[model samples]
Target: MSTMAPACGAQQPGNIPTPFDWWPFVAAPIIGGALVYVWTNGIPIINGIVGASGAALGFSTLTGGAAGAASIATLVLYYVLKADGCIRSVPKGANICFSGIVNDTTDENSTAVDILAPFAMGPAGVFDVVVKSTYWHYVTDDSFWVYCDDAGAAMLPCLVKSETACGGHIGSLVGVTVGAIGGVILGYLAAAAVGIAIGCTATGFFYLLCLIIAFIIAAIVAAVVAYAGAVIGGAAGEGIAAAANANDPVVKAWKGLSPGDIVTVQGNWVTDDSLGNNEIFYTTSINRTGNVGSPGPYTTAQADDAIPSDDCNSNSNPPPPR
Candidate 1:
């Protein structure tokens, strides 16, 4: 019996074509969520996307929906907690600007690649206490930390600050030259006195002539030694200065920073999960607004004054939410 020739691609008795795959629908959202995770942690987007895509493809129809739902739930929970003041989640690329007194600084590392300085917003003890204890901390959270980076160094006051580190060490060169000349003169005199006897001169006129010659020779020697020393010292000084300037602008700026200086930091705000969702300013610019020795641990009013009117807290003042 001819079995109806399988009706041209119709489903066979036992083999029903699997329903159109629903996994792709589920995987798309999951992949997107993973990308967000990668981006927040500073992973390259293309790499994160490719890796996430690969991971998503492995999901089967049964597991795909569950994974996608979990991703959605995780994202929703993050935001909800963020709004409820239970979690801190600052989106990447939020414009951030604030001013404060520098409190402590962490040296650059391979991961950060920039100097991180934590500054004080309000009075150190009071503000720090409030931030640690309060639920609504984000409003005041930004005032404490800054990243001194190469990009920020190219900006206004930072360039001005680093410029001071670029000049040659003229004082060191001069000191070395003077020291060399004095040493040569002392050594020449000591050797000449040891070899020459006072009685060797037959007449006073002869002795005077010899003395004149010795003085001339010593002067010439000192001049030669001083010139050679000057050249060497000058070169060393310039080399040192050049090496100092060769470092990235951020390093130069970091050298210039001090605890008492009032600084205004500007950059994109990112919440560092690695630092426990602590917000950081990935600096584009750092300005030494003023140099007031130990201006903070300020009162709330004084801290408000430290911030520029155009910045993050322009509308609100800090000290636990209203």
Candidate 2:
């Protein structure tokens, strides 16, 4: 991932991917889901970060922090790195973007790496992390509760509005809807079992109760199935996409990461925001063209022979002129 930093130096090359990565793509969601269970009781480690953002709509409780950021980052990185064949070269005096939630970022010239990433400055903490992508995936870990995706995070609000909210609200509703359906079924089954023991079907009023029970069971089953189909169906659709791309080249597109273009210091960066007072910026425009010290996934070449590449020298900062 080409960070918005300059003085780009080198480290190790990234690993080439193999077909084996397909497994992680399939297990990503399953494994992540399981962690929620394990850490359900307020992840003691970084629970504070969740409330950092406070609630979004009163419906919001610590957004991207429901599941532990470290947990999600670890799970995601383990799979994504394998899937993407990304490498973590040594901290080349440039390139600083750490994934996962960064909480209490206080380091001085220290290097903090994304646990998923072998490289990406580290030792800092995440206040919270928002995965900006095709889906609204996040974990709120501050004051409210740690949650993931729309289900863990989006479900609560839905449940408040309707017990049967599906589509985006399915995650929250599944528990209530499924539980009620199961309870009704079991209640009917139990009633029938008791009836069989004493032959209550022919007992007039008792027989009428059995008929009502049976009807209620049937109706609930149909409604639960309909709602569930909507929820699981969305997941199945994502599975189709994962299966399709499992063998394709890893899409090395990290957010806002690319090569070739020189980004003027639109932002500030440091080894660790706490590590040193020396924040690194484009004091000079360094040329990455033909500069083998660049990071990947490489974008298409931008300049041709006419353009002169700036050296990673201090003088190059502010590139003397054209």
Candidate 3:
């Protein structure tokens, strides 16, 4: 009787983890595989049908290859245009100026800012504006300068100095051009391979096998081409972003200052009126520069001309000096 009764205590549930916890990892591959199968099968079927029709209508393999290559080229071009900020209107009175060292220049005089025209196309429209930039080094100051213009009209003053452009040259156009050429060449080869696969499929009892083979080959090629394109496009975008960030004056100034450098920032320091006779103020003070100000960086304060006491005292008698 004493052994029959279990120890009297709060019952605890068994610590059994559920299979649902692994659903995400399991489901992702399944979903991805389904999508890949659908996409590969769908694209080839549509493309093969069109290609066969064209072939029957006297379109040679070379022409078909060229057509396929051109499609890839167009896609690359569109991506480049979009990435380069060419698909948007340039802000009024603002000239688009790009600065970077020439990664590949044919001549000695290589300093330049690759100007991009706005997206629109028409007479006097965005794309029509002949945007140009010229780089010059001032011998007297040992500084680099750039001049930007749109249709012969000057925009903002060039703020980026020349020494900063010494980094490796990389830009949207460069990446896109390289990618497009590569994509087209690869696409052409893929189309040729498909044609060969189709021709072989006409042999006896090999149609299903040939189709499967052709599909796998085509899918691999397409994936390679797409991956190359994406990489190129991403590189170009990063280059553009880098170029813009490098040209910012605040960023440049911040870069020039080193750790423990003393800097005097001149600005207003607003305080509650109850603090003293002087509330709104202007002051120059020294602080350790390099992101955060360090202690022992002597800071001085100065008061600005106060608003007339009449304006501040309209509601009630002003308090006497503390």
Candidate 4:
């Protein structure tokens, strides 16, 4: 048997493959992915996706309680700052520290920062820049700096009676946006995993992708929440060392507060009770406690603080007598 070439005129009935158009191939995944994202963002299906994702990730780490706590924590911090500007503001009672020269030292490994300034006639008082943010493990020397009326002042620590100030607000706001974008990517992956397991179609897959994107938005929102938790937690964590400024009028006026630090000086017990009237008994405390955040105003013994009954407790402020 022999194969013969067909004549040009009789190229004959042979079928030819059509040229492949790049548009459909290129656009399908994109369009499909986009549609999947958008469509999955709507009602019913979106909830199902999250519920499934939560289930897959395990409810232990990502629980409704955690999210709710994050939200409530953010709102509480908002109000705490709102309720009393003092909680957010530095001690204005004494601003001009005679300490013309601000001397600073840092712990290179841990980056613990200390500032020494003359407080009135008292010796140069060395204070932590972040009395409240002590628990924060990443504080660098650059976390905060001193601002003097005259940076060129003489070497002696003048009457340093200045209050601490919050330094990371502006930087934190910028970081939140970057965190949001990164969160979106994480959410996409989380949602996609759940979406695909449910037998998502190509188009449906992209729509689901959008849902996870929303989750990233949500996570960023949660981070926004954590920001407050951080603030509250930070403020609630540590307090002025009882030994630090026992005689500094500036420190006493501020009631031993550091920048971003909020504490109530009530009957010797300091409380970072965002909602409690820790300040009500401020004048009564002969020996005021320092910054307290995590466990907050109410410790385990003080169940009343958690629910805030008629009064505070022995460990903390007891809401005055009815």
Candidate 4 Cα lDDT to native: 0.29
**lDDT of every model, 2 decimals:** 0.35, 0.27, 0.30, 0.29
Off by over 4 Å in 4: 1-165, 168-174, 197-249, 252-322
Residues 1-322 of candidate 1: C-alpha lDDT, one tens digit per residue = 1111111111123332223455557656766675456335533433443354443212121122222233333322222233211123224545545555444344332211111100000100101101111112332232222222221210111112111111222422453446443534343443244226443364666765665454444434444444444444444544565576576554445556765455656544444332222243334455655554543333323333544453335245343321
What's the lDDT for candidate 3?
0.30
- Model 4, 223: alpha-carbon shift in Å? 4.6
**Residue range 1-322, candidate 3, lDDT tens digits:** 0112111112123332222444446545754564455344534434564456553212232233333333444444343332112333211221112111111101112322222211111111010011111211110011121122221221112111221121112233344345444543454456556756467545659866665554444444544554455445444454555575555543344335442232322222221122111110211121222222332221111000111121112224222222
Best-matching candidate per TM-score:
1
Model 2 lDDT tens row, 218-276: 33443344333333432343344335444321121111223322322111222211211
- Candidate 3 colliding pairs: none
List model 4 lDDT by residue over 75-116, tens digit each: 333333321222443212211111000123211111122221
Clashes of each: 3, 45, 0, 21
Question: Alpha-carbon error at 227 in model 1, in Å?
Answer: 49
Q: Measured by TM-score, how close is model 2 to the native structure?
A: 0.20
Those runs of model 1 whose alpha carbons end farther than 4 Å from true positions after fitting are 1-91, 109-247, 295-300, 305-322
Q: What value does the lDDT take at residue 64 in candidate 3?
A: 35
**If the candidates were sorted by their lDDT against the true structure, best first, what order would they fall in?**
1, 3, 4, 2
